[model samples]
Target: MIIPFWSRLRLAPRIVLVIIGALLAMKAVDKAMPLVIRPPEAMFFDRDWLLATLQDIRDRSITAPAAERPALLRDLPVRQWLDITLLSSPPDFRHSEREGGFTDLHRRITDRLGLTPQDVLLKADEPDDPEYSPRPLVIILPPLPTVIMDVFDDRSANMLSSDLRIAFRIGPQEDWLVVTPKSDGQEIVRMTRNVALPLLAVVLIGLLSVWVARGIVKPLDDLAEAAEKLGRDREPRLVGSFNAPELQAIGNSFNAMQLRLKRFVDDRLQMIAAISHDLRTPLTRLRLFAEYLPDPDQRRQVMSDIAEMEAMMSATLTFASTQLKDEPRSPSDLAAMLISLCDTAADAGCMVAYEGPDHARLVYRPVAMRRAFANLIDNGCKFGSHVWVRLRETPDAFVITVSDDGPGIPPDQFENAFRPFVRLESSRNRDTGGTGLGLTIAQDIILTHDGDIMLSAAPDTNGLVVTVTLPRQG
Candidate 1:
C-alpha cells in the first residue's frame, strides 16, 4: 500500500507539526472545558458584601480620629473573603482617551458611600503583564496608581474583565482605602490548572518527538546492516517498509545496485567455467598425440605438460563453478566433519590427527565448507610430514587451525599465496599435486560465509599454521 504524504514527512517537520497540533488541541480543550462544566451564579462577584464593606470603611474614616484612621482600616480582619488595606494616596490609573464603560459602576460606588463621583474610582480588568501581574502590582503602580488585589473566582482575577474593583479616599483628611476580595484555595487551584495545561502539552509533544526520532533512525540502521552484509559478500535481507519517502528511495536504489553487482559477478564466473570446460577437450587431444611421439623423452615431456594443463583446467573449472553456485546455509557438525577428513587422510597413510570438541554445530553451506576444509587438510598433508587439525571456539566465532611441520612460507609471501595459480616454491610445489588454487578456492568459500583465514608460523614448530575463523550465528 502507498504511504500517505503525512506519514512520510521528514523528522524535523513531523515533530514541529505534532507540537503545533498538540498546542491547538490543548487550546480547544481549554475553551470547551468550561462549557462542559459551567459554574453556578453563586460563584460570581458578591456585589452586596463588597458595597457594604466599602460603606463601613468610609463611615469609620469619618468617625475615627485622623491619626487612628489608618490603624482602623489596617486592623480590620480579613473576613468573608474581603481584604481591606489603607494607602497614603490613590494609585496611578490607565487614563482612557475616551470615557470607558465603567462610568455607571463609578457612580454606583460613590452613591453607596454618600460621596461624589470624583471621590470614587472603578477599573475593569486589564490585560496582564507578566512582570506587572503576580507581583504586589506596586512596583509598576504609578505615583498615584490604582490598587489591584487578587479575588477568588473560577478564573484568574487578572482574566475576569467584569469584576467590581473600587479605590477611593475614605475622608477628606484620611488616607485612601483599597477594598477587594482576597483569593481562596479555589483560586489557587484555578491558577494551577491554567499553568499545568501548557506544561502537560509540552511533555506530550516531547514524547511524540522521541517516537518520530526512533522511526527515522530505525530505517537508517537497517540500511547500515545491509551494507555491512554486502561488504562481507553475503546476500542480506533488508526490511522493505519505511516511514519516510527519502529512506524508501535510498532502499530501492541500494537493492537495485546489489542485484546488478550479483548479476555481473555471476556472468563472469559462468564465462570462466565455460572456457575451462572447453580447454579440457584440447588438453585430452594433446595427451593422445603425446602418446604417439617417436622419441621416448619427448613423449614423456609432452605427457607431463599435457597432464599439468589438464590439472590447471580442472582446478579453474572447479573454482568458477564454486563461485557461481548459490547455496542455502544449514546447521552442520563441524567437529565431526574435521575428524572424518583427518581419518580419511590417515587411511591414505598421511600423518594427520584431529583434536577438538566431538561436536560443534554451526550454520553454513555444508557442501562448500566441507570442500574448503578438505582442500586445506590435503594441502597440509602434501607439504608437511605431520599435520595437526585443531578446532577452538571463542565467544563470537569458531577457530580452526591446521598446523603442518614443513618449511613455512615467508611472511611477505603470505598475502600472495591465495592468488589463483600463484605458488610459492618455499612452501608449495607443482610435484605436490596442487594447481596453486587450493588456498584460492578455500578463501573464496570462507569469505562467502562471512569467515576469514590467515597464515602464520607455527609457534612451537618449524611449520606453517593456517587459521580459519567463522562467526557464530545468532
Candidate 2:
C-alpha cells in the first residue's frame, strides 16, 4: 500500500526508544556473560592428593612410636589451614581416633613446620630467597558476575574462603580482581551492568541525536525568528545557508519574498513622489500668473501655496530616495561628526550643544549618516529652544541622542510621527512649517545602516528626544 509520507514516518521505528533499550540490553549482557559458571562441588579438594594424605597420616600414626610420629609428618609434604572441622560420627570408632588426629594435624601443619602464615607447605618449587617462599594459591573465583573483596593485611593465608582478593601485576597491566565466597547472592548480579554493548549503543545514538537536532530544529528556529521579525515591521533577515537541501530551498524562497516586498514598498514611495512632482510644476506656473493680480494679499496667498507645494515635492523625493542612494562607506570619527554638526547648527542660530569624548571612530556611510543627523537637529531647532546632541559609547552599541526642550508630541503619536507626511498640527502651521519627512527620512537611513531610530518624551520638558543606536562594525 502507498501510504502518505506523514503516516509512513509516524509508523517508522521509534529510534530513540529503540536505542535506549538496546544500550541497556548490551550493558547487561556484557557484564553477565563473563560469569557463566556453575557452583563448585561441595568441599572441592584434590581427590588423589587428599586421599593419599589421609592414607599416609593413618599409616604413620598406627602403632608408631611417639618420637617417630613427629618425624613421619616432617618427611611428607602437606598444606596448612585444611581440615574436616565438621564430620558425622563414623560407623567404626577406630578410624575416628586415627582420621580425626590426622585432620587436626593437617590444620596445624604451619605451626608444626614453624612457618609463618605466608609460607606454603604443599608448593613443590619454593624460591631460594627466604622471603620468596611460595604461598598457597587461593582460587576463590565467584560464581556470580561481580564481587567486592579487599586485601589490606600483609600476613595472610590465601587458601581460605574468608580473604578472597589480592593485588598483583600482569606485564604492564595492573588491576585487582575480587573473587568472593562460594555463597554468591543477588547482590553480585545487581552491581554488574551489561556495560560493553550499552557503551557502544549510547555513543552511536548520542551522535545521531546531535546530527538530527542540528539538521532539523536549529535551522527551523532560525527561520522562525527571521519570519517573526519581518512580520513585526522589522528588517527582513537572512537565513544564510543550510545543510539540508529542503531548508536551502526554503531560505531562497524567503529571500525572494523579501525582494518582492522591498520592490512593492519602493514602487509605492515612487508613486507618491511622482504625484507630488506633477502637482508642483502646475503650482509654480500658477504662482507666476498670480503675480499680475491687482490685489497684494491675493497674490501673496497664491505664492505661499506654490512654496508649500514645492516643499512637499522636495520632502517626497528625500523620503522616497532616502538621501544619496550611494553614500561611500568610510571610517568616520563619531565625536568629530557630532562636534561638526553642533558647530554648524550653532552657526545657523540654533541653541545646540555637543557632549562626549574627542575621538570615537566607526565605519559608516559618512554622507547619508550626516543627513540623518541634520534632519534630527533641524527638528530640534524648529520645535524647541535648546537642542542637546550627545554621543556616547556603550559595551554593545554606540548611542546618539538629539534632545529638544519644547512642546513635544503626545506619547501615543511618538511612532506615528515618523511616517511620511504625518506631521503634528502644531508643526503643520505656516509659522512652524515642515513637510514632515524629516523624521521619516532619518529613520529610513538608520534602518539601511542596520541601526535604529527611537523617539521618547524628553525629561524636564514637553519636547521629544530622538535616539539612534548603531551596532559597531569591525
Candidate 1 lDDT, 228-275, residue by residue in tens: 776556454555868777777888888888777777877887898898
TM-score of 1: 0.57
Q: Which stretches of candidate 2 lie over 4 Å from their true place?
A: 1-206, 221-253, 290-299, 322-325, 425-431
Model 2, C-alpha of 432: deviation from truth (Å): 3.2
Q: How close is candidate 2 to the true structure, as a TM-score?
A: 0.57
- lDDT at position 63, candidate 1: 89
Clashing pairs in 1: 91-144, 91-145, 91-146, 92-144, 92-145
Report lDDT (CA) for all predictions: 0.72, 0.60
- lDDT per residue as tens, model 2, 387-418: 99998899877999999997888888888888
Compute the lDDT of residue 251 as modeled in candidate 1. Answer: 85
